[model samples]
Structures are given as structure tokens and as C-alpha cells.
Target: MNIQCPNCQSIRITTKDEGKKVGGVIGAIGGGIHGISGALKGSQVGRAVGSIAGPAGGAVGSVAGAILGCLIGAISGGVAGAKLGEIVDQRILDNYLCQSCGHSFSIICHAGHSEPKIVGANFFNLTD
Candidate 1:
């Protein structure tokens, strides 16, 4: 599933994809670092063993790593996403004048497949 900006009617990236993308990037980085460390220690396969060993160490470590990566990624993605949303929101407000007042107004952002709420009336005002 995906989320969309209410004001500009643009599709925004979803948390799920953001989290996974972040996790994958981090995991690869971690794995590379671990491998480097392993190579330094002469483990032959170095951190390359993580791919196979990750599961064998039980789901705990693997899950922990992924979750840790995800959390970091999600937070980072969320902040960036919010900023991007703001840009879109501003564009919408600047371009799409209010029907009633014919004045530019801020947008009210929403998530999921729900309908778009009016810019000024929603609980979470995207303008702020």
C-alpha cells in the first residue's frame, strides 16, 4: 500500500518501503563493516558469514539487526519524508487556491487510502 498527499494529490512513499529500504542499506553497511572486521581478524569469510550465521544464531540477532536498522531508517526517512511533504504541501497551497475564498491556503496531510481532508480543518495541520 501507499500514502498520498491530500493537497497536491501526489503519491508519497509508504513507511513499509521506507523501513525496508533503510534496513537493507544499513544491513549491507553493517555486513560490510563486520566483514572488514572479520577480514582483519583473518576469519576467511569475514563478515560474509553473517548472511548464513545470522539465522543460525537464532532469529533473535537477525531480527534485532533488521529492527535496529529499520528503526534508524524509519526515523530518518520519516523526517525526510515530512520535509518533502511540506514542499509538496506548499506547492499545492501556492497553486491550488481555495474554492471558497480563492486564497492560497496550507494543506492538511493524511495517510492511508482515506479521503483527503480540507486543508485548514484537519486535526494535524500540514501547514504547521
Candidate 2:
């Protein structure tokens, strides 16, 4: 979407994806922690399966399974987090950035009117 800077009327706008970045980090950490249980289960399964190949194979399989489990959990969590962060961005954060004037703001729509509201600044109607 093309967005113009409310302060300078510049069309160069950047999205500060703070929520997405932060959420992804937090989610990855949480997912990694949660995946520990899965990893242990996977380790047992892998050991059982690899027993046909003897001790060396079982050891390798256990490590591989644990790593795979953790990776899957982290990836899934990061994706979920990013999706949630997108919602947060749309709902709560002033996600728009103006490249020309360095003004950060969000567009607020009320009564069918779309107006730019600067973050951490006083509210005023742009139409006025």
C-alpha cells in the first residue's frame, strides 16, 4: 500500500515492524522451551527405531530427533508469533514511518474519515 507522510506529504513511508520482530523473538524462545518435551519423546522414538542399527545408530538418531523437534517447534512458534504481531501492529502500534520528515504516525479512521495521528503528539483533525 502507498502511504503518504502526514507531516511532509512525502510518499516515502516505512513500516517499523517492531511488533513482528519482538513477537517473533519471544515466540521462538517460548517455543524452544515448550519443545523440550517433544524433543524428549522424539529422542525415545528415534532410539527405538535406530536400535536395528546398533548403539552408534541409536545415539545419532537420538541427537537428530531432538534437534529436529526443537527446530520444528521454533519455526512454528515464529510463524504464529509473526501473525499475532501483525494484528498487534494494526490494532495498537503507530506502525507508519515517514522517510522524508522522520515523522512517525498512524492513520486513524473515525466516522468514515481517515486521518493521520502522530505518535506521542497532540491529536488534531487533519481535515481542519
Identify the candidate with maximal TM-score: 2
Q: Candidate 2, residues 5-120: lDDT per residue as tens digits?
A: 66777788899988999889888888887788778888888888887799988998898888888888888888888888877776677777888977777665431345443332
Model 1 local distance difference test score:
0.43
**C-alpha lDDT of residue 53 in model 2:** 99
Which candidate leads in lDDT?
2
> What's the distance in Å from true for residue 75, model 2?
0.6
Model 1 residue 66 CA deviation in Å:
1.2
Question: What's the TM-score of every candidate structure?
Answer: 0.30, 0.81
**Cα lDDT of model 1 by residue, 1-128, tens digit:** 23233444344322223333444555555555544443344332323445566645444444445555545544554555555545554444332343333333333344332754444334323354
Supply the global lDDT for candidate 2.
0.74
Candidate 2 differs from the real structure by a C-alpha RMSD in angstroms, to one decimal, of 4.5
